[model samples]
Target: MLNAIEMILICLVAQAALTDLALRKIPNVLILSGLLLALILHLLSGQPGAPLSQWLAGGCAGFFLFLPLYLLRGMAAGDVKLMAMVGAFVGPWQAVQIAALSAQLGGAMALWMWWRYSSKVSVGIPYGVAIALGTVGVVAWRHH
Candidate 1:
């Protein structure tokens, strides 16, 4: 019983994850499109508690939450932007939860990669995968 927003979120994250895995980069066009779609959907839905302010706040929350990692060079700009796009779809609170879950998943992936590579890992992990999985988990859980 996924709504249009949920469906679109799934598609956006799936595409982002695949692109990041294949090219090690998430494209700006993808993020922009998601953001634009989110805005339109939110405006059209007229759902309570989903005002334009919430949308902007959610995007800001997601961006700021990941900004430190980007500044430290621990992650790419694409990851940050992807998170912001996700927040635009969800909201500030769910975005926070997704960020936490994504961080945990990304850390686990990093550890596994380090161990599997004998601590000589050269390439960055596709963190968009973690973000995608986390977002889906949170959204599904909320629906449940």
Candidate 2:
């Protein structure tokens, strides 16, 4: 049962990573799909309406977790929402940790991208890839 969500999340994370790497953006459809999936799964599990606290925590974690990077122009707003969706399914604290790790990975990758393309184009790497990858790492670590 839980594996189902895990699979879905893993797949989506992979897609997000690819999109971020290729297009430099995490599409709205992908993030929306994740939220919809969690809602549908929550309903199917007979939990109809998940506790408001959980959703609130998830949203809060997702937003504030990425705020610093956003302020620093290190990431995008879309990535923040994406992480929130992940939090909506996983919870707050874990989501924060995942975001933190992902940000670290993203930061390192961004630096590399910057250096690699220093003379080509002035742009930042799509950090959604890092978030998705980081989330996967946290999930696997949590389960193990």
Candidate 3:
């Protein structure tokens, strides 16, 4: 069940990356799919439909966790939605870890891109790529 969740997460992230790369936006379908997949995974894992408290906490956590960045326009709406969906799946702590890992990898990629492109780091980073990669990383680490 977790494996399926992981696969869906990775695929959704990849879809986000691809769409963002090609059109500078992530499709609504991709985000919805991810959210739905997480909900299904949670239920399938024999957990309650994510207790209201958990959902509320996770949603708030995920939103606040990335709110400042988004407000600063450092990330897009899709990225934020994706994180919230992930929070629904794994709760606050794991959401934080995933965000951290994604940020770390995304930072590296941005730095490299900056170095290669006039040493200027813009508010925009191709973060969906990092998310896609980090989802796989998180899933692997958690399973192990």
Candidate 4:
């Protein structure tokens, strides 16, 4: 059985992935709503396994994990914020795992796109898809 936070995290990430893939952007509304809901859930639910400090650390870790890529113009601001919101839900260590997995998934996607596109046109990937998928993987792993 999934906890409330876990379910919300899945829904939020799924929504982000859908929006990102279709529109090529992850909306601020989704990220902010996810963060706000996570904080509220933490405050009200008294969830086990992680305290508020750990949640904050997770958010920070998630933000910093992708900050370098964003700074290098290799990623979008929405992707960074999306990961931070995911961190707020999953906590620090899991967030690290998710970020690492997300990077691998994103790289695979890039390679696939490169191979699929024989033309030399530049194409930007919506990394939120990778982040969402990675988050789902981590959450599913925790469940089993």
Candidate 5:
């Protein structure tokens, strides 16, 4: 059985993936709600160590890591927010891993799409799919 955190992460990633694929936009409501829920979960977990503190650190890590890409126009603000929400679930180090893995998946998908649809005028990538897959991959790897 999946725990609360895993279920929440899966839901967040799935919702983001669907909206991003369909509309090319990640909604603020989804991201903000995910963030709030993650913080609440962390606070409620009440582990020996400060889970909320770790979550905050993770959120910062995710925000800063993707901020550069957003500033450079390589990524969107919604994507950055989505990642920060993810970081709020995982810790800083795991968020870094998720980001790295997602980037690689996104890059590969872009390359494949470009190659396969060279004639298309626009081959925009749905990056949230990559993030979702990456999150799944990391979770599986960690739990294994």
Candidate 6:
């Protein structure tokens, strides 16, 4: 059974993926809500370590991880924000794992799209799906 944090992360990423697929944009409102929820959950978790710092660091790690790609025009801002939202839930270490896994999945998706569409592949891929899958996979693996 998934905990509250896991459930919320899943719901957040699922919504992000859906919106990204349909609109090619992940709303800032969603991201902001997820971040706020993560902060509240972390505060209530009552872990020994500094929960606030962990949350901030995790968010920064996730954001910086993809900032370069965004700056390079390789990805959209929504994708970066989505990752940061995931990070806020899981923390920096898991966020890194999710980013790596998401990159692999995104690459596979890109390859498939390239092969299938050939010269007609102009639309941006909905990378939030990869991020969502990666986040869910890591959370499941950690809990299992």
Tell me the TM-score of model 6: 0.95
TM-score on alpha carbons, each prediction: 0.95, 0.84, 0.82, 0.94, 0.93, 0.95
Question: Tens-digit lDDT track for model 5 on 9-116?
Answer: 988899999999999989999999988888888888987564656688888988888899899988888888888989888979989999999999999988898889
Once fitted onto the true fold, the runs of candidate 4 whose alpha carbons sit more than 4 angstroms away are 47-51
Model 2, residue 57: what's the lDDT? 76
Worst 10 residues of 4 by lDDT: 46-55
Clashing pairs in 1: none
Query: Which model, 2 or 5, shows the larger TM-score?
Result: 5
Query: Which ten contiguous residues of candidate 5 have the minimum total lDDT?
Result: 46-55
Best by lDDT: 1
RMSD of each: 1.3, 2.4, 2.7, 1.7, 1.4, 1.1
Query: CA shift at 95, candidate 4, in angstroms?
Result: 0.6
What are the lDDT figures for the candidates, one per model?
Answer: 0.93, 0.78, 0.72, 0.91, 0.88, 0.91
How many steric clashes between backbone atoms does each model show?
Answer: 0, 0, 0, 0, 0, 0
Candidate 3 residue-wise lDDT, 88-139, digit = tens: 6567877788888988998998888777876554446767777667767887
For model 2, residues 64-136, the per-residue Cα lDDT tens digits are 8887777987678788778878887776888888887987898898789878888588786777778788988
Ranking by TM-score: 6, 1, 4, 5, 2, 3
What's the lDDT of the predicted structure labeled candidate 6? 0.91
Candidate 2 weakest lDDT stretch, 10 residues: 47-56
Model 1 quality (TM-score): 0.95
lDDT (tens digit, per residue) of candidate 4 on 1-104:
78999999999999999999999999999989988888888877765645467568889999999999999999999999999999998888999999999999
TM-score for candidate 5, please give it. Answer: 0.93
Candidate 5 steric clashes: 0
**Higher-lDDT candidate of 3 and 6:** 6
